[model samples]
Target: MDTQHDIALTRALAEVPGPLPVSGVIHVAVPHASRFTVVGNHLAQHAELSLTAIGIGVYIQSLPAGSQVGIKALAARFAEGETTIAAALRELETHDYLHRTRERLANGRMVTRTVFCNQPGALLRGGAVAPVTVASVPRPVVTPVVPAPVVAPEPTPVPEEGPPPVRLPSRIAPKPPRRPLPQPREPTPELHRAASALLADLRRHAPELVLSEGDVEELVPGAAAWLERGAHPDAVRHALTTELPQPPKYPAKIVRHRLTVLLPPPLPGAQELTAAPRTPVTPFQTCEGCDRAFRSPAPGHCRDCRAQYWEAA
Candidate 1:
């Protein structure tokens, strides 16, 4: 009976579930003998960094010296767009994991240099290992043995020719005359109001075009000139807003440049307004003899009436 009880207890225990197997990551780490990068837990488990940024930081740290890590190069290697890669690089820079600076090369070309820090905190705290300086050893001076003295020959001088030839002056090409700037029309109250409204409304099409009140007032004359020249309001707006720089440094300056440089010529009919007026046509006159209307310079008679009177004479 004891054996039976023991067997029953063993069966019951076997049937019961032993704490459900822990559901979590299991490390299967392998010791790397070569070509391995050591990443600190601070960076690998960074709370603020996104997965892409952390991964990029680690990749940059692992790269050999003088590797191309520009946004375009990184984008080509990874499955990310240039913008995303650039943002990740900026994130690494912000966290002190990376330092990028624009340097001008000896050839006068600008280049960006990137420096990766394995231990950002250490670097920030100025904890970098000092370079080892080797002490210079003194060498024993050797005595020189003197031999028989030898005489040296002197160089022969050449005779001078007549006066040096005169050099002709180089001909300089004449510069082309610059185009005259377009002058703004005399601004009336209506023109000023229209120009102001156009300048203010530019921000609606492009948020970067936001202008201050003073800038708008200053730009009003140029915008008015565009309008006075036969350019439609839409055309002027397109000229001002289209193909703007990635981030316009000075929006008002851009508008002013476009207004002055791209101003259209005035309408053809506009210039012909000073021509003489046309003479009026002859009016219709009623002939007194036949009671018939006819076109004449005066109201006296028609052609037929004048012919009859002449015949009677």
Candidate 2:
């Protein structure tokens, strides 16, 4: 091909996504002749015993030696009377060991190119600045590894069998005295509640016992978790002592379950309070105990008065 045609083919080859199959090139070069080489995706075609075969054989041989085959010119030369390039290509396709590709020109023309070897091989045409090579597919190359040497363990010295013997060595003195134990920390309110709950259990289940508040406090450390859950101490101790389906001795689970059981439906926000007050308060007749006035407080007395009145009544 001419230099202009060659440059055009180079640009076309570069435009291809990767190496072209020779078939791809042929498809691109269907109506136009171009000078190009294949980089990837081989062609499959048959070439009978003809000038085309000879030229292809020659072209294959000339590749590593660096020769350019103006593919269109070569096809014209080989595709003489009654013999078609397609037929020749069909024959060439019988060979399993060849790699081929097709490239397209700017005008959407194709040139089918081929190589004798498999992929990652190159095809160099004359006057081209760079040779076309298929990108290599990675393959793992396994190498045998030598194992490290085994180390022999040192033998432990064994004492000979004998009777018991005397003691020795007064040089090392005993360790110095440790400081006195730390003062105990006070139990938190939650711990106190939990302890009381457990003590309540003892009061019920183990009715014969009389444990002082201090004794209960001491035992609190062990059962304070139950008390914190608002459980009575006696019930907690009975459950623990009796191995009744006692809860897991963890405050988190206990409190969580307690809240889950005791939780009421959520109250509506102020936005939902659409009703007006039904019972308005009066200024006089305040309860003596609470001093808050109310209109006809329960039993005709205010909260404090009612408390005293209820106590007396």
The residue-by-residue lDDT of candidate 1 on 184-249, one tens digit each, is: 768788888998999999999999999999999988888888888778899999999999998999
Off by over 4 Å in 2: 1-55, 63-71, 103-113, 118-313
User: Which lDDT value does model 2 have at 33?
Assistant: 24
Query: How many clashes show up in model 1?
Result: 0
In model 1, the Cα lDDT at residue 160 comes to 69
Candidate 1 Cα errors over 4 Å, as ranges = 1-21, 29-34, 72-83, 105-111, 129-303
lDDT by residue for model 2 (1-313), tens:
6999999877776775656776633334322122333323343232334557544643553344223333444565554533465555445545432334675656555644444442212323222224343333345433222111111122223468798887887889899764331121455875667555555455355334445666555555545444444455445554544432343344333323332333233346777878876887644565546667776635356666767778998
Which one is best on lDDT? 1
- Could you tell me the lDDT of residue 2 within candidate 2? 100
- Which TM-score value belongs to model 1? 0.41
TM for candidate 2 is 0.17
Question: On a 0 to 100 scale, what is the lDDT of residue 70 in model 2?
Answer: 35
Per-structure clash totals for the candidates: 0, 37
